[model samples]
Target: MDHNHQDPSTGLLTKEFAEGLGQFMAFASNQETTLQMGKMYCPCPICQNRRFGTVRGVWKHLYSRGFMAGYKVWYSHGETDLMVNFGSISQQNNLDEVGEQQGGVDEHIGNVQMVEDRFRVEEPKFEAQIFFDMLDAAKTPLYDGCRDGISPMSSATRMMSIKTDYNLSEDCVDAIADFVKDILPEDNLSPATYYEIHVSGLGLPYQMIDVCIDNCMIYWRRDVVRTSCRFCGKPRFQETRGKSKIPYKIMWYLPITDRLKRLYQSKHTAEAMRWHGEHESNREISHPSDAKAWKHFQSMYPSFAFERRNVYLGLSSDGFNLFGRHRRQYSLWPVIVTPYNLPPSLCMKREFLFLTILVPGPEHPKRSLDVFLQPLIYELKMLWDYGVEVYDIASKENFMMRAVLMWTINDFPAYGMLSG
Candidate 1:
């Protein structure tokens, strides 16, 4: 946040702070709850809200000492918005990002939780934490004075891109961040190091379910117990966070349910997702709607076709060597799913092609591939039967959105494996 910034023209407090000060005084005017009955906690640098002052006294302290650095979030006041975790929340963790001479540690769970604790009324589950992170990151500006519409999440993504494109080291990234931060205005928004920028949340969410090392079976559903593989009797174990060994290797399952919901949430693609239903494609076979299978499925299940927003999806899988041709002898199988509801061009676009599952392999699973597909299949069933609550952007209404897997896109070997 922009702390201690002065308006160049007036040589006084920034427009934001000056404006906020008025609101703070107004709120304190009527509210009886404060550091004292007739006084509020002084948020100025001299008092740091630990000292109480009358409205006039508080104003004088702020005018002389300036508001405490990074006091954008009014947590002491009655505001409990998600962004209130900023500035003071790190008091429970490290505060080097606020320009402490001792330097800063890399961003970690402790630091995150310390900030997050300020906003939580009760203990949040894993999903709730993720939701808050995603929400806050999206709402937060890239920096205090950012006007480009970029956010911290987008900034982290761009940093990742540059790091990969140039193969920069962590130290090099730190140096670059330091240089950029030095040149930029003095604000808490620009992190000093790449480590400090720690990007996380729903940006990359994938389930790591236990799987049989031999790909014989996945340790899911009723088999969540059992110390060994059901089919081959091979031991499946991995160390948990508590250092306890648990059965099963791993298979990455990226759920498509949330991705589908986001399609309707975004204004950019919400309209495009239903383009096939709204626009006339004629009989020219430009999209999947012009194909026989799409029409056949619609005719057979008119109830499913009744909702124009209901998604039709295509599932595809392929196997490829993980280590190019000759370095390491290992393969990887990736299962991708795409919606057929989009126009032909967008349907094939990389952004829309969702990779739902990754079946690990020194070799392909072959007939055992179904073992890794259990989660995807379960989610698909849920989408078809129960559906999910979604907010449509174009219609500006909530609806129960359903999805159906129309067909599979795969080579002959994959097709055969799936059938088996």
Candidate 2:
């Protein structure tokens, strides 16, 4: 008479419910198919060689694993419905105790049974708006190309519709914003000045005036521009003068001085700067002679002077002919410079310089003056005497050279002409 006395540990499903679930698993399994060794095959457990022999095998597997107990089963047939609650095995002991007060084991089981009149599956329905709403709340909204199933939210078709309706996603907006912020007056100064110094100090015999403007320098010999790889040192042409030679050439602009500043001012820049400054100090001592050399060079080579207040140094080569030419032919490298700081006194006094030396042939001697060699060596000596510190240097086959330098005048006499 005590309902609580029923099996308290293994709260198995009622016999009728277990049979119904077994039938459903069997029906679902029979619908799957497979391919084996170029032949199509049926995937039903009964038709395949596997441990699970039939649809009933799968149902028993699910039951032994405890998925059937206390689960809800909803069946509907044209508005006629039935809901069966199979109390979970883990909750069985408690239910048994409660059942004693309401009725016995038979009564409790009857209360949770589903009626035969309700036994149909509902068709699946899509909810598009819900998906789109979730996408709108994302931190970074999806772009247009993303609508073609390339974005994170692409799985939700409704979200793609909303993105298309708004026309708000554009790939280049962020890049343009970055560009505008960089070209501002305050952000563009340092690289402009440094670029000018490098070009002049290198004795390149060319001018680059506008550091902030992109692609300001142009190579006169389009043919020579098409040779070798500048960064990777790969040969680009079979012969310097032959049509087979690759034109090794490139166009360069000053580093984005103001753009870099704006970049640093952004939230991301702060964290990056902190890490870089801590890990590596980019500072160096400036030399006085380098400053004088630049001044003298600028005076002598007026053609190389840029009309703009700042300049940037950069290099590029015509990829087709880069490897075929000797070092001397590619000596006229482009340089970039931009301005930094303001107030003539603080900004004008700063000096930036770079040097590039191209050695011709593998056995070229130490004193060999290949093309623009004399002016470059003279500049180096002048920079050394004035106590300028060298920052970087690089050289390679067929004559490619590059160097960087910085200069400053410390404790100028009060009456000296350098004083404001």
Largest lDDT belongs to which candidate?
1
Compose the digit string of candidate 1's lDDT tens values, residues 1-420. 236545668556676765555555554434435423455666766446544455555655554445788776665554446634542343323223222321221122243553343232323345434554587667787667788667766666677678889999999988987887788666635556777665533455677888888888887779888788878888888657877786545788999987888787666888788776656766688888877888898778765664668999989998998889788877799999999888877889999999999888787687988878889989999999989877665554456689999889888988998963
Lowest lDDT 10-mer window, candidate 2? 391-400
Off by over 4 Å in 1: 1-140, 145-150, 159-186, 190-200, 238-248
| Candidate 2 local Cα displacement, residue 400, angstroms | 37
lDDT scores for all predictions?
0.69, 0.28
**Candidate 2 wrongly placed segments (more than 4 Å):** 1-252, 266-268, 275-328, 332-420
TM-score of 2: 0.16
TM-score, every prediction: 0.60, 0.16
TM-score of 1: 0.60
lDDT of 2 by residue, 173-216 (tens): 33433453366444322112222223222112432211101111
Task: Quote the positional error of residue 13 for candidate 2 in Å.
Answer: 70
